[model samples]
Target: MLLGAERGAGCYAARVLAKRIIPCLDVHNGRTTRGQQFGRAEHGELRDVGDPVALALRYDEGGADELVFYDITATAEGRGAMLDIITQVAERCFMPLTVGGGVRTLADFRALFLAGADKVSINSGAVANPEVVRAAAEHYGSQAVVFSIDAKKRPDASGWEVYVAGGRKATGLDLLEWAVRGQELGAGEIVLNSIDADGMKTGYDLEATRAVARAVDIPVIASGGAGNALHMRDVLLYGEADAALAAGIFHSGQTTVGEVKRLLAAAGVHVRLVQHATLGW
Candidate 1:
């Protein structure tokens, strides 16, 4: 278990901060759900899992380093982060929580912080005005700001293009260019979520992740497409990502945070120690 001094306001630990495991909870219509490839459900409809708070508690028990609560429909619907859910989860879970989806202005960031969010993530908002990244990072410090980029491979397979508004709107921004811009604008970290690989559970897009990781000086969190421990290991080591984020695999009980961390540790990767982990637990 994590000690009192260890669980601070910041999401990352002092030492093993970059190499960490994060679990994402995507909520649609107030219920936690999972789908393939950014809203495309392979089975025709999304699998409504359960309450997000319940899932957060379960992931917390599995020893996730950080938890991300994304209101999947908030931005598309033109609203704000789910304060009710954030407050509820913050009241219970001790781990760092990042809330995103529909965060537009500085006031939105303030409200999220007041509700006990450790970090505020902005996707469409940042794309709309890159200056917001600088403003938020300056006001709250880069540590509290997470710039999330949803990218899809172009039709010509030349490179990836950034997407926003629930992956329905294309911004025509190059992945590497925007990643560098986000860092230049003072983003503490960048979450590179692949539209093509999301929820596929095959593995992360290593080439894209490595590119973004190398492009930005800040920590790059590789999101989307996590199947098993080896897949995560490949991304963290080979992909050169500072961290890995997953949703479907863990939500479906195919794996747990502890399981992934154990594998990474056994492979000589640095990860926060969890209870019962052989590597220093």
Candidate 2:
């Protein structure tokens, strides 16, 4: 559990921050992928978008607030994320880069940072060994640690449960409780991925997002179920998420990061819009 000194401090400090538009690259075996839920499109499938380096370059030109790369199968396969991709992306992207999947120790965080990752995200590792969260924060600052949580609604309609190992196992932990504990444990931010909303295109599970956001003091990034820009607006405003992460909508060419940011701006949300470097401001 987080101490009283840590509780809600991060959240309060971030209350006035601009809402971020993040593009997520779900990589499998070195290729970017998109699927309806957590399912990965097979190697030859058209859903295997292309090289992550190319996609990162595109998003960088499009004015994305940040880039997130998740090695979708790393934890399940018991290996680390490909460092070559992170190195390539860091060299090309000017914005912050967050890498996740298969992060299990301080060494993992060290390797990711040394390889050009601005931040490291840990899900299963944090759940399995909560001490790693503290260790990472101690080694690096808490600001460099992002704790990702995969959550699903309970069968009894009670609350959400934490899922780990690429959403394959349940931890029987309450979503709200885990988020609070994560903040207490020194995580700088939280990425709340909704299993129920994964690939649904029905918009985010605002109920789950709001519940977790209210429970913690850190920034909460809403992930999954984003079919369009309206969904991103809803999550940032009503759901109270500090950032919105989308994979399918952007990967499938259904939407662009600029489109999402523009829509949110029109809807009265504060976001970083890149004015034309072509024209003097």
Candidate 3:
């Protein structure tokens, strides 16, 4: 049971476990990159930020609860994630690491675990073969598997639709139904990335997030459109997410994990605060 309150009726409440703030690294060709709403970079150059390993170290020291690395182009290119980078980041960053992209089989899960990933995220692969989620969970324990859903709002404004292959292909599956199915298949957690809200920085698609959180039993991590600490707070509290994952805001030096934590803590939300000696803010 989490540290705070229990889930009640319409009023969404907090769980005692401190909400996690994760910094996402979307890697392409072994380099970290960021684009608006998953767009291609200007010209032929990727938006190279810094070395993934180096950035992981900074975030780890700076007090990120966990790190999520996505080999953004792996699925599109029909290749696996760059294991070398995963291994390097795993070796250096002490916090929990979740590695995604190209996790198509139980073997891929084993390989990532052996490479030091604490959790393996499955997106397209799981959509293509739902049993893979069950098989991995049975073999590696549910805690080791995270079902990642990239969802976009439907054309008729009915509900969210699932997208795969890095948000390029639509699965035509209902978002709430898929999340419940993932939970039934033994996924330990759900990562809901709203394609409509991604990179928009307007706010999280609270409607979609709240719906999935209410539908599933597992913890939900809301990804995309995190502009500031307020957005993080809203997702965790009102949106009912267990954690909030953001890329551009953290990658562009707009905010730090510690800063977000302090704000969350001050807002009467449970969050781990990093020692001031390191943050200096």
Candidate 4:
């Protein structure tokens, strides 16, 4: 069923698509980890939550619409996508999977697709040579290529600038401009991740997210700051994001996909809720 955003926000008659709930697994050294705003393990902040495959199974059974797995350190470590783990998770979980990090060429996309990734996200590689995204889109169809941008608000709070290498390198690319360019290059989606809000759950960067969503025709997945179901609601209605991605909250057992969807449905946000015959909603 289609739903409308906050009618008071001027979307009273707008037909909003069913919002997606995507759980992201930031795997570091083969273990799923969580940290505040891109904190590393060496800084005594990043904490290993559990096995990636185990968590994937949990989200899959908990009613997640999709799952995203990022080998957080893959780019920094100069490696390829985690094919073995991805294959393991894909074999067990029925949800679509989006894999990012260490994806640099057509070979990477081919390997990921063969390994069971429904979509491949590219960042630094796209910056270095946007043709990678264009070529991948042409070869695998636009729906399989997602241009993921890691952005941090400028020091003066003027605008967000793109970052790469796991939010460690600055690219000086304006977020909105890059998003539009990505869409022009045939990207199927834009995963706009806010570096400043990476793990802080107060709420999403609504203002920034809306700008990107309005600037691109492709679906925009807002990443980095979802504390509760209400936050997800705000981002979709006010931020205009097609989906919201969260990590620490779900990984720390704060909430499950079912609980979030239940709350969202109660608030009039359209989402795919799992059915139950014994315990009907």
User: Which runs in model 1 stand beyond 4 Å of their true positions?
Assistant: 1-18, 40-44, 276-281
What stretches of model 4 exceed 4 Å from their correct place?
1-16, 276-281
Over the stretch 47-152, how does candidate 1's per-residue lDDT look in tens digits? 8888999999887777888899888778888777888888898889878888899998988888888787888899999988888889988887788889999999
lDDT score at residue 255, model 4, on the 0-100 scale = 82
Q: Write the per-residue lDDT of candidate 2 for residues 229-276, one digit (tens) a residue.
A: 999999999999999999888877888888788888899999888865
Which parts of model 3 are misplaced by more than 4 Å?
A: 1-16, 41-46
The order by descending TM-score is 1, 4, 3, 2
Candidate 3 lDDT over 1-281, as tens digits, reads 21101111111222226788999998987788876666654345357887888889989999988889999878888898778887787767667788999989988887887777878899999999999999988877777789999999988999999999988899989999999999999988899998888888998988899999999888899998898879999999989999999988887889889889888988898877767477885
Clash tally, candidates in order: 0, 2, 4, 0
Pairwise lDDT winner, candidates 1 and 3 = 1
Sorted on lDDT, best first, the list reads: 2, 1, 4, 3
Query: Each model's RMSD to truth, in Å?
Result: 3.7, 5.1, 5.9, 6.5
Candidate 3 residue pairs in clash (backbone atoms < 3 Å): 3-16, 3-17, 4-15, 4-16
Better candidate number, 1 or 2, judged by TM-score: 1
- What is the TM-score of candidate 1? 0.92
* Model 4: how far residue 275 lies from native, Å: 1.2
